[model samples]
Target: MRKQKCGVIIIAAGYSSRMDGFKPLLKFGRQTAVERVVALYQQAGVDQIILVLGHREDQIRPYFDNQPLDVVVNENFAEGMYTSIITGVAHLNDEIEAFFIHPVDIPLVKRETVKELIAAPQQLSKGIIYPSFLGERGHPPLINIKYRSAILDNKQGGGLKRLLALYEADAADLPLIDEAILMDMDTRADYQALLIYDALEAPNLCECYAIWEKHKLPENIRRHCQKVKQTATDLVAQLIDKGETLNRPVLQAAALLHDLVKTEKNHAVKGGEILRDLGYPKVGAIIAVHMDILVDADTAITESEILYLADKLVKNDQLIDLAIRKEMVLNTYHDNPEALKKITRRYHNAEIILQKIQRIIG
Candidate 1:
């Protein structure tokens, strides 16, 4: 029972009346046309992407033969896209925090854009989140699971647009989403026009990381951050194994930059304040918990702890044993017995955490 924050329903059932035939099967780049959309959803790490198919299930099924995907055919596709939308939600089974509805023709959607959209609802105070481009509403609108019953039993003529019209304010408008959200290939011109979007280019994830790393951080700290990032990644696998949280990247970045503001003594606390001032409130919040128990014990093996533990294991740029690591931390912070005890306790906790993480890395 893997818990997920978002589920995607790809409405791929509509007949491409303008492309003459097989528009979803058209190729634009690395994968096929429909495949591009599927790849985006897969990259976004959604709980599940139910591809609502019709017209040619055999042809569509061939592309995902080796891929793990959920495919369902809409027998009533002739009725409308809403029929397929209803069909896909049936398999969701309370397993998602939100539902993201997409159309397969909108293939150029970026993974980072989807990730930001998925995270907005939980990160914001309003409770629900949606995507828009240049102030206009866009596709793959994310609906929170709290409204599951209304969406499930929507009698507004089986049209999602109608349901949206009823309560437009329930959505959060995200202006930063890429143009792909507004581009669906219903005609030949639309299909040909999709060749321009490259969210993989500037201002996306890789770009963000590039700019983020440009703070001129120290080499030793950077190397240590990377190692802790690896360990935090390993921890995510462990937590997922135990049916716990699968928070992606949050712990990784937190682990990497826990000691970001390393001066001489109060680096952990200082680092948190700096990250906060730098518009990384999430990272700062996580880093601030290094010296305190902001969350529970299990989650205490959190970003800060992951960073602290990862820092402890480093000796002259190499990973060392827990005892030696603990001894080093004790000596480094000789004035603080409490930090030593907490570090040691965390190492004691890492025995189980490391063993579990090794299952995936090893």
Candidate 2:
């Protein structure tokens, strides 16, 4: 089948009055906010891209020099964001089947989210595909080019949100697991938080559960993960009180998602790979070693250690003594010598972690 021709309109014309800085030029890791947004669509194979600039256009215009996308100036940008949308939609190529209107302030949206939106219109006959996270709609709604005339002709009192409401019957909400879809930079504090979130590369608590629902994890595994998360939380509180610094969020997310691929062979590694691909390398690293982590006299009491120990303490959603857990493991593999050897090694690793936790908390 021929690939759908996708395009994007990145509106970067708003005054940074609330942000106290240029929203498009702010650095998010290595790239500026606008740069990141452009790269997102470029990587998603968007055939055409038009950036609408108005306020401080000169400052942001040079960034896209010789780039693949066309840059248009929205002289009436001060009128409202709607003007920029009209400018961007007018510049879209005639052959473009559908397009997305993204704002420069929402730079952290995952690339996977774009791909999903691009693919949604194929299965469902919808004019607009709004990405909804936890029932909240978010930026960069993928719009069918058929609405180009309606948008250009719109003189409504409200902005795009209000105008789009008229076409609700023709629109469909595509539920996604990306929390970044709902995140945007409206103030300095929000920008700082987004920077930290970008660095951590892990999902928030709500997004983690959304992932579980998206993957359709069995009810039993979900219960087990909840208990593991609780166990890790207790360990984090105790460890923090003892002057041992640990990343509680990373540890808890790993604990909850460690068994993501539990029904598959080599589930620990598989689950880790899945998370790493989803942009949570830190959580992935912890889950990767949850099944059989390396421990020694020099091993520190980090988040990985906490997760490893917490998982061992929980047996099928119930916290059990490490000794009883080991006994059950041994009995399960008693008839197979090779399996027994691996099980014994895992138990030994769990004991070392248990001892370290006891030493810290006591």
In candidate 1 the C-alpha lDDT for residue 259 amounts to 59
List the lowest-lDDT window of 10 residues for candidate 1. Answer: 199-208
Q: Write the per-residue lDDT of candidate 2 for residues 1-362, one digit (tens) a residue.
A: 56689899999999988987899999987899999999999988899999999999999888889898999999999988999999999999889999999999999888989999999997778989999897889977999988899899987669888888999998998888788888899999999989988876577888888889888999999999999999999989988998998888888889889999898999999999988988789999999999888888456687887888889899899999999989988998889999999989988988888788888888
lDDT of each: 0.68, 0.90
On a 0 to 1 TM-score scale, where does candidate 1 land against the true structure? 0.54
lDDT of 1 by residue, 42-106 (tens): 88788787888987878888888778788889998888778888888877756677888887877
Model 1 lDDT at residue 216: 56
Error of 1 at 336 (Å): 46
Poorly placed runs, candidate 1 (over 4 Å): 1-4, 198-362
Per-residue error at 147 for model 1, in Å? 2.6
Clashes of each: 0, 0
lDDT of 1 at 262: 60
How far residue 155's Cα lies from its native spot in candidate 2, in Å, is 2.9
Task: Give per-model TM-scores.
Answer: 0.54, 0.91
